[model samples]
Each structure stands twice: as structure tokens, then as C-alpha cells.
Target: MDQHVKTLAHLFLDGEEDKALHFTEELLNEYSLMSFYEAIITPAMYYIGELWETNQISVADEHLATAICDFVISQIKGKETVRSGNDQSSGRALFFGMEEEQHYIGLKMVSESFKAHGYQVRYLGPNLSLEHSLIQINKFKPEVIGLSAALSYRLPGLKEIIKRFSELEWKPLIMIGGRMARKFALEELEADQVMIVKDLHHLSKWFEEGREGLINETS
Candidate 1:
């Protein structure tokens, strides 16, 4: 990383909100928004989580760190495209959850990662009904759709939702990931892709590979 980015990461790790925000904005001005997300914010978030896990930071501190990180991300404006441009007709995805699954941190990170990789993201907020999900897919017409299932109990509902999508003429590349995805076996969910993301690197690689395959096929 460059000097400015290294400083920004330290500020975030030290929980210095004001300094970090200023640094992030400067980085945004100097680099592509996607670069800031993929290279800066994503990695810093991983560091914060690791710090918390090792008891080096308090829960309150971790929460504050995430809030500050989110604040910086929210301030970012402009094209907001990842490796791709603003062609909604191309490289599209809908990321959301099965009904009753409430955790959103992982989903939010996944959404941001997808956007950073140039995929046009239609992020459906948590607890979306099957009807609402179908509506968004029909409207966006994305190439891929992902559902978050954080709870084991909601797997049946998730399966039904996947089944409905499969039945559609415009069936997307369906994928599932989260705690439930990790705790359970892949054969159980029966998704086209069953993923358990341990960090942003894994998430980034997955999207890049998926997008490359799509491009190759289209080419």
C-alpha cells in the first residue's frame, strides 16, 4: 500500500474517526472509488475483526470501528462502479436474504465487494419476501442473484425461494452464503454455488472468477 493508504489504515485501526474520514476522502479523490473499497476499506474491516477476535479490542470499539468504516463508505459518491461501468444491462446481480434471516453485516460486505468488482448491484435489504425478490429480479434482470441465510432454521424457506427462481424463465445464477452456508454442507442447500466467506480476499476472488467466466462465455 501507498503511504497515504497506510496512514489511513492505521487511523481506522486506532479508532480515530475524524482522521480516518479525512484520509478516506483524500484517497477517494486520488484513486477510484472501487480501489478505496477493495484495497482500503475491505482490508481495514478485516483487521478490525481480527483485533476483536484476539481480544485486543473491546466490543464497543469494534462496533465503533464498523460504524466509522460505514460512514466513510457512505460519503463516497460518483460512478461507484467496480471494475465494470454503469451498463445496468450488463454484469448485474441481486443480493438479499431469505425471509426471517436478519444478520446483514456479511451481506453488506458481499454487496460492496460485488459493486467494487464492476457488477451492478441491486441490494435488496434484509428480510425480503419471496414476492418482493421475484419483482426485483424481473425488474433488474441480473445475471446472478445471491441470498443470505444466517440461520439454519430458515434453510427450508431458502430452498423454496431458490426453487421458485429456478422455475422462472429468467433463472439467474443462484448462490447462497453466510453462517448457515458454513455450518451446513453444500449438498444440503443445493445451490449452484455454496460459499462461506472467511474474509474479503475470498469474496473478491469469487466474484472476479464468476465475472470472468461470464465475460468469456459472452465473448
Candidate 2:
């Protein structure tokens, strides 16, 4: 993990896109997808975010790093694999980033993760209106509705969206993630059936626990 972390940090921070891509591919060849995401991709991005927070790096640097990581994740996710457990998928889902929230890589990763698990995942990237999101949800009729907001300022918007979703007569399971997700408790939000997911591991664990759908059912 340390070796991969250093490699990712060097490649990503130095603006070496081709090198970064090659390095990521090499890691994928040598390790599991989850290992690459958890050990290299996720941790590296978190460090980059922290660097921006502490003024160690410029916003442009952070954005570039994120874009590169985004490309790498998408590349890995596009690879074919033989899934082992249930022959059937867990369920369909619609994912989006909240209004004016531009940090969307995390949500993108979630989309890829769902797709890996054979879920019909619809990823509407970044800064979508509630009304627009609702339209997709209605159209998709997904079993899960996912929301991500990296900015704390978007919490009110997130709250409003979740509240409106809760009022729906036939609501899907709602999952929210991002840095701000850790700031507030669920009870404070006054919404049941709403889950706060911190990372891909937690999201997959939710699937394994049979919370999202019948993932453990026989093939």
C-alpha cells in the first residue's frame, strides 16, 4: 500500500498523466481492483484533497489529479471480469451529485462499484436539481437512489432532497456520501431508510448485508 501510495502521489502530483495511467494499469495487473481503489486511488485522492485544504497544493493541481484518477478508475471499471456470487444482480440504482456540488469523483467511483456488482447503475454526474433527479428516479424506478455532496454548504440542499424523497409514497433506499456526510447524524436529518456511506467498502458491505437487495440469493 505504501509503495502504491507513493507511486500514485508522485505520478498524480507531477501531472504525469500517461505515467499515471500506465502505473494504474500495472497495479491492476498485479492486484485486485478493490486493492487498487482502496490502497492507491482512494487514499491518494484523499491526500490530494487534504493537500488542497492545507494550501499545500493549488485547486488546479487537485482538479488535475482528480481528473486523472477519474480516468484511471473508469479504465479499470471498463475491464471485463467473471463475477462469483449471485448470477443475478442486486438491483438498479440512480446516482447523482447534489446541486452546485462539483466534487463528483467519489460518486463516479460508486457508480463503477455498483456496475462491478452487476447492478444497473445510472450515474448522473454532479450538480443536478432535485426535480431533475426525481425525473430520472421515476424513469428508472431503481431500488436505490444515491446522492453525493462533497461540500458542507450543500447539506441544506441534501436535506431538502432527502426530505422530499422520504415523502414519496414508494421510496427507494437512499444512500448519501461525501465529506459532509460524516458531519451530521441520521436522526438529525429526520429521514428513515437513508444511509450514509463513507466509502466503497461500506457500500459493498451494505450489498453483502442484503440491505440494498437480494445479493446473496442463489444463482
Candidate 3:
């Protein structure tokens, strides 16, 4: 909410990682990394996209903005959140992008939302091979595995990955979210836990409602 935080977030959106990191650390120390992200960074990203779409900024500038935001996000995610007081741990979730799908911003945002809702989020970063990802799933044993695909064409590859996982005898709740999932619809994916994302707020609300682990049964 502070003007300086907004300014720093804009700087980050404009691809100024050094300045963004400095400001992020200051605010994070005062508040929390999640607060800095929600209050400034996310809004700044939307603003940057708007500027680019409206021709106020160039494609190169938009890419630069994304780079800076990713850097700042890495910084924020490195900082731990306040521990949930509940003795019973909520389910663990893993988020990643399919191989050849370079976009990870959506995955990052959704992972943060899950974490805020008390899920242990294991973020595997971007462009991971299906084999490597399955190894991660086996290693971490998360209750949910979320794959994010930015483009629609990547859906088939994502499905292949899911099929590979299914063969492993132990399959986690596989949720896919992003532009592809939202537009193409999750019914087409045939995954047991697919959900269409209306927006970040909707995703957050869904996670909150399901934090107790009975969303499907109640519905």
C-alpha cells in the first residue's frame, strides 16, 4: 500500500531486479514476502502487461519486465512464511511447468496461493522433463501435483506426463491451471482433479474452502 512499495514493484516490472530486491527486502522485513507480493508485485505485473498491450511499452520491455518480476519472485519465495498453528498438516502440493512450456508465472502465483492456504507447496520450477518430474513426485510424495501450461498445444504433452504418472501405482491429485486450462476447460484434460481458474482470487477462495479436504464430497 505504501507509495515506495508500489514504485519498487513498478521498477521490478520494468526489469530492475537490483532495485526491486532492495525494496522487497525492506518491506519483507517489515511485513512479509507474501504481503509485498500481493500488495505491489502482482499489481505491478498487471500494469506492465496493460502498458505493453496498449502499445505504451514494447515486447522487449514486457519480456524484461517479466524477467525482473521472476527475479523478485525467487527472492520472495526464498523467505519462509509464518508457520500454520494447526498440529495437523494440510496436504502437500507440487507445481511445475511441462517441458517446452517456458511460462511459469501462473504456476508461481498459484503455488503461492496454495501455500498461503497452508498447503506445503513444492515448486519444481519450469520446463522439466516428464521423467524428471515423476522422479520428483516419487521423491516428495505430494498430495497434489499441479502442472501449468501457457499454450493450448502443450496440453497433449501435459496429458502424456499425467499418464506416465498414473502408471507409477501411486498417483497424486493432478491439477492443471493456466491459460490453456482456463480456456480449453479441465473436462477435456481428463485429470481427476482438474479445475478451471477464473482468476487468482477465485483460486485462493477455492483453496481456502478445500483446505479442510472435503471439497468434492461436500459438493
Number of the predicted model whose TM-score against the real structure is largest: 2
Please identify which of the two predictions, 1 or 3, would achieve the higher lDDT against the true structure: 3
Per-residue lDDT of model 1, residues 35-139, tens digit only: 566577656666667778999888887777766666666555333553356545348878987777665656776776566556778888678899988898998
**Candidate 3 lDDT over residue span 93-182, tens digit each:** 898988877767768877876675567778998888888887888888888788877787776787787676666555566766766765
What local lDDT score does residue 93 receive in model 1, on the 0 to 100 scale? 79
**What digit string (tens of lDDT, one per residue) describes model 2 on residues 16-120?**
878888888788777666556756777788788788899999988888888778777777785523543435677898899888888887788788877777788
Backbone Cα, N, C clashes tallied per candidate: 4, 0, 0
Tell me the TM-score of each prediction against the true structure.
0.63, 0.84, 0.71
Q: Which model, 1 or 3, shows the larger TM-score?
A: 3
In order, the Cα lDDT scores of the candidates are 0.67, 0.75, 0.69
Better of 1 and 2 by TM-score: 2
Which lDDT value does model 1 have at 122?
Answer: 87
Error of 2 at 196 (Å): 1.3
> In model 2, where do residues sit more than 4 Å from their true spots?
29-31, 80-88, 190-192, 212-219
RMSD after Cα superposition, model 1:
5.3
Ranking by lDDT: 2, 3, 1
Indicate whether candidate 2 or candidate 3 has the larger TM-score. 2
